[model samples]
Target: MTATIEQPTKVRRPRATLQLLRITLVLHALLIVAQPIAAGYFLAGNVDAMTDIHATIGGSVWIVAFLQTIVAACYTIAGHGRLWPTITSAALVIAEFVQLTFGYAQNFAVHVPLGTAIVTAVVWMTVWSFRSTARLSRREAKR
Candidate 1:
């Protein structure tokens, strides 16, 4: 009689939605960072150019935040991401809208601090999303 040896199968990790989330999150973070820099330029006396640039970038951040929320939702529903990322993303979008309103109303007292908080939150999410591994489903692990 001969003894047989068994080899374990290798499984591939599927990270499509996760990758999408990371990419969008990073892009959103970049946009969030750019807003303050543009505002600084405007405050530095480049009002005409920097003001337009700041407004454009500020609007762009909202669109990116909305997309990030959607991507996070997909990631969570697909069983890859946790609930917190989705929750945070939704909250970030709402906060961003409030920040936008504050800016339009010339409420710097609220806008400045809220902008700082938004940037901090987005940066944290981007770093966490990229560094952490998603919870893999059994079906995914077997593949």
Candidate 2:
């Protein structure tokens, strides 16, 4: 009998939407980390304009959060990834909106603690998204 050659298994890659989600999540995490630094600069009397920069970054975060939410939804539906990412991103959008509102209202009581929570959540998501567990598609997940 003729010898049979075994074909090499194909290496699967993440979908474009998943890749986009990872980019957005990393960007979001970096921005979230910057918020505390910017706030510290303003608090330290280093730069008077840091308040404006802080606010600008906060606004940018809102836009990014919204975009991330959409991408997370797409990843879940089309890419067949987990649904938690979509829920988490949507919650972040709401939380960020609240954070901006309280920040503008000068309610440090809520703003400070909430900012800490948001940063923690974002960092957690960013870390998780990079892990193999988060990369598991529905088929792989079932396996």
Say which candidate scores most in lDDT. Answer: 2
Provide backbone clash counts, one per model: 0, 0
The residue-by-residue lDDT of candidate 1 on 1-143, one tens digit each, is 99998887654443787889889988998889888888988888898745588778776787788999899888777745566788899999899999888888889999999999999999998887766355453345345
**Per-residue C-alpha lDDT of model 2 across residues 57-111, encoded as one tens digit per residue:** 9877988999999999998888788888999999999999999999999899999
For each candidate in turn, the TM-score is: 0.81, 0.85
Alpha-carbon runs more than 4 Å astray in model 2: 1-14, 47-49
Q: Pairing residues by index, what is the TM-score of model 1?
A: 0.81
| Residue 19 alpha-carbon offset, candidate 2, angstroms | 0.8
* Model 2 poorest 10 in a row by lDDT: 8-17
Screening candidate 1 with a backbone cut-off below 3 angstroms (N, C-alpha, C), the clashing residue pairs are none
